[model samples]
Target: MESSKIVKALSTVMDPNTGQDLITANMVLHLKVDAPNVSFTLQLPKLDADYKQQLNFACQEAILEVYPEANVHVHMQNPAATAAAGQGSGGPKTNNPLPHVRNIIAVASGKGGVGKSTVAVNLALALQELGGTVGLLDADVYGPSAPTMLGLQGQKPKVERVYGKPKIKPLFAYGMPVMSTGFVVEPEQAVVLRGPRLAGIIRQFFEETIWPPLDYLVVDLPPGTGDVQLTLVQTVPVTGAVLVTTPQEVALADAVKAMNMFFLDSVNVPVLGVVENMSYFTPAELPDNKYYLFGKGGGKTLAKKSQSMLLGEIPLVQSIREGGDEGKPAFVNKEDQVTREAWMKVAKNVARQVAIRNELLPETRRVEMK
Candidate 1:
């Protein structure tokens, strides 16, 4: 019933990494209590798959002894990566550039051809459908597909003067705002700039644009762990990330790498969960049939192995593919109940995971790396 009793229980569980009780090291954060229910976030300074699982069990056991009827929710968070020498001056300070935005989620895949962009686009639409104000940022600068995916091909965001300075207005589609490199260059143009130049472009998106306040901003990142991904993570205060992958060994390998990046000491971005896109196939005619075309359970395995949540498993649907090519994401089509429901499931899971993270952890922002 009292928060202190829960804190006292948590203090009994030793963190394997530090060999100290979580309370002693300031690992417990955002603690709250109600009769027969307790919730708090545990910010582990370091984490691995095995140790994290052990810590969760130990903490739960410790708490249940104090309140046998407790409904315990322990949200795990990784600490902010230490700033490198000459990267920024002083200790880590919150560098939240877009205070108006409630949450910024990066959707990434281990590699290309895994439907990461498709997932990103539909997920944004579905989030909007759930009565939340959402925005989409096509951070894949080299191949900005959000413009086409959102039915905004050949469109450009308008620039307007605001307070004696020029500001770009994000284009709206389905009442949700969007911005992307596709709006600036021709459809076939290649973004051949180096890291520094890419970082500059991303910086402008955060500091210069006049984006409306939003509950969630879904950023579709380019596949693979590259400079663009690093630029966005280092330059922006990403709330969290959702990983996309197929249910195959090869794709799972890369998804592991992508997931690992978020856990890196230099990155330290909390991964909301893993979404297993193209998990399987089911024929349109035979509604009751199922097929393991890409093998099965890769997403669940990855999530379990990484100690992250397996948000949802999306089956391979033809209309889902057709919708993207036709400049209409499947989630927006109300007539296609099957496709819409599949994506809506993922969207709901994503929203739930993000909500837990936001409630438990401090807002993440770009800190100067001195």
Candidate 2:
């Protein structure tokens, strides 16, 4: 069988979203031809499981029509891997496009006002506190709260000449690199943006920023499984994702969607675990009391239902709130050992999950069909 025949057949298969053939969109990747056996990979824009299966089947059918005797091996390749394969620089190459960074972790939520940003801020700090060099990217375009939480609001990314190219210098807070849309625009000003514009900004974060060598880069994604979430997963080589939700029925419902996005076959971004933020409330005056403000065990239930680790249950504490507002993440301050430990436990669980993912799965693809 000839690879040219397979390419021509792929060219006939149109993308439902773009109204263009897969070959035209450069989706057909790594095509190989062998007598009685043919193998190829598809790099899709979005990873809808049903759609991928259909596309794979259609491609196989098309190829078989021309080469009836050939056996086909079709694989879905990640965009990150495809991009990494193209770079011809003499520098050390990595499967991840972001070679300077060791690991990229995304923090996501199903809905807003679930303390997602709060969890993201504290978690980044928590990771850094655990002796890892970390960078935090606030991917929440509509609600870029990481700057305020990280105490880097109103700060701007500086441009420097690196290797004869202009590179964005990430702002540092509490000894860790930080970037956010808040840095680009005024805090109170509403960003009137659409999907493409939002995606462009996210792309800029990875490509433009001259990030130093680091252990981890924690991305704070906007709430919901919208453009920002898709853009982050598709563009960056994310190691894993952390789903944040409150112990409430409504929040858990949305959290389910967010978690499943990472679990999708095309994306396959391993959910490091689920974090139950504001799991319970502990009054400052009465430290011994526990209040189920948003109901109980929702995080644990969600984790169990999702078959993911319950990273940690963070309580609704006044100090945690105060610390975020004051540009001091509670985890960074060891004064309140209880709150510090709570956040620290989550951080450790995240690290453990990342380590497990690297050891077992290694690459982005977590599971495969037999």
List lDDT for all candidates, in order: 0.81, 0.81
lDDT of 2 at 147: 81
Q: Flag clash pairs in model 1.
A: 86-370, 87-369, 87-370, 88-369, 88-370, 89-370
Task: Indicate which candidate wins on TM-score.
Answer: 1
RMSD of each: 15.5, 14.0
Summarize candidate 1's per-residue lDDT along 1-370 as a digit string, tens digits: 8888888888887654323567876778998887777888887644466656888888889989999999888888654433422356654554445655788899998889898999899899999999999999898887888888888999888886532356778899989888898898899876799989888888777666766668998999998888778888776788899999999999999999999988887788889888998887878887667898999999999888777798888889788888888898888888878778888888898889888888888767663443
**What TM-scores do the predictions have?**
0.74, 0.73
Q: Lowest-lDDT window of 10 residues in candidate 1?
A: 78-87
The pairs that clash in candidate 2 are none
